[model samples]
Target: MKNIIILCFVCLVTISDTNSSSDGKEKCEGIYVRDKFHKKVVIGMGLNRPYQLAYDHHNHKIFFSYNIGKDDEDSFQIGFLEKGHIKHKVLKEVENGFAIAINNNDNVVYFGGSDGIYKQHLKSNDSVIEKILSHQNIWDMFFKHHLYFIAYPSQKLYKYEHRQNKTIPEHQKIIHEKIFQFAIDGDEDKFFTNETGLYRIKNSTDHRIFYEGPKVYRAIEIDNKGVPHFSGQNGIFVVNKKNDTLEKIAHVKNIFGLAFDNDNNIVYSDPHEIVKLLPEDC
Candidate 1:
């Protein structure tokens, strides 16, 4: 059944590539944020190569990956900052890593690279660096029901069941040639992605398109009111699931990462600097 699905997906990819004109030429505008009162609190410095971002809800901290140099072969480092603090602490460094996901415990983090999947125990400073599956370049990772779901840009999905000590193919229902970004809601029953526009996957077989846009890099499902917040080359978009409306909240030209805190604050990082979106002064 899975092989059949992969074959069908390959056919679709060929068709889409032939029909489409270079993945849409529209570039995102308004890439910076200035307060209504003209206060520029956040700034983008442009880093070497930044990738995934994760929020530690329990400790109110945000984590992100940063490359050391311009070369794609440069080493990458994982760092985190407190909710209201601007300083960051480098947690770990690696040769090549991306698509990182921090466990709910805020102590365990999972990431993938050209090699395979790995886990880091933050508290003990010990890591379980093992290759779960070979030849899979992971683009994103998230936890659902204690199981780790990894998305590979090459249209492959993997689930690592901790209890079973095994990795298996999952998300057989999604049929996209390439998936740029995806976000798993806390409940694990629903997820949003930008494979063929923003889509909500209710189950392995049930799903719906929330909205359509250019290729997206990252996304998060906001619990404040269930808004589907996403970032791409253009800017940031907030999808109102209740009314099915998409609003362009802030325009950041190069959005590398995004996360939301328990207090409903939004945090994002470009290349060099990280910024937070705070509510208007009350």
Candidate 2:
């Protein structure tokens, strides 16, 4: 999934790498608002192709994977924000470092690249990159009870169990289509999204469509209380847990990655900067 063009759920729109203004501020375009309002703020700047944000609740930092330069000159690196500064220490650059995950319980951050999956202890003073899985191309991944990922080209879901040290196909049921990204709610309810819509797997037997909006949602994230947020071309949308309704929260253009900080604020990326969407009242 190199240089893949992601589409929105409601309509078709394409995103570019640069959309800054003449005065050096990034211009947010194609905004479509709804009932709720959120103030968008740029938390970090000067990045290239930042994708897939994972938040560390313990340290309250956002870790992301990005590429410098383009095409043949591309170099992959992992970055994290510190004290509102773009401070990043490259753990170890790998081939196509596109996926990133952080385990708060183990205090470890995992990086998935074309070569394999590598992990580094976050709280250690002398952290070193250690290869956990090799020779597998990982496109997008996340850490729950285990590592859940969508392997590129095939686009099927696989689970990597750390305790057993095994990678196996999701044996509960068979997914017929390609899956993009997935998230588990606070209740440990598993949900996934594909070309059609978002689906929930209940009791490992019932696979049903949860939401049918956005034909091609790129990123899906859940907050601390199990509320789900989706990102596409239009903006960020949230599924309300109390009333079971979908509402547009923020209208961000070309939003790449989706994440929720410890405070439940939305953190996402555009082309060249990382943005945060916070509630206006908060």
> Which candidate gets the maximum TM-score versus the true structure?
2
lDDT of 2: 0.72
Angstrom error at residue 222, model 1: 4.4
Question: How would you encode candidate 1's per-residue C-alpha lDDT over 1-282 as one tens digit per residue?
Answer: 999999999999876666443455322222333222112245334455455777766666666777865575656766666655666666544335666777655567666665566776655434455455556666667664453455554644556643476555465345444555555654343555644566666545465646655545465544444455677765777655667556677777677777666766666777667766654432
Kindly give the number of clashing pairs for every candidate. Answer: 8, 2
Off by over 4 Å in 2: 1-37, 71-75, 87-89, 162-172, 240-245, 280-282
Clashes of 1: 8
lDDT of 2 by residue, 37-122 (tens): 46768877888867888888877778888877675675677777864666555545566788888777888888888888888887
List the candidates' TM-scores in order.
0.67, 0.77
Query: Where does candidate 2 have its weakest 10-residue lDDT segment?
Result: 8-17
Alpha-carbon lDDT, every model: 0.59, 0.72
Model 1 pairs in collision: 28-234, 31-251, 31-252, 31-253, 32-251, 46-272, 47-271, 47-272
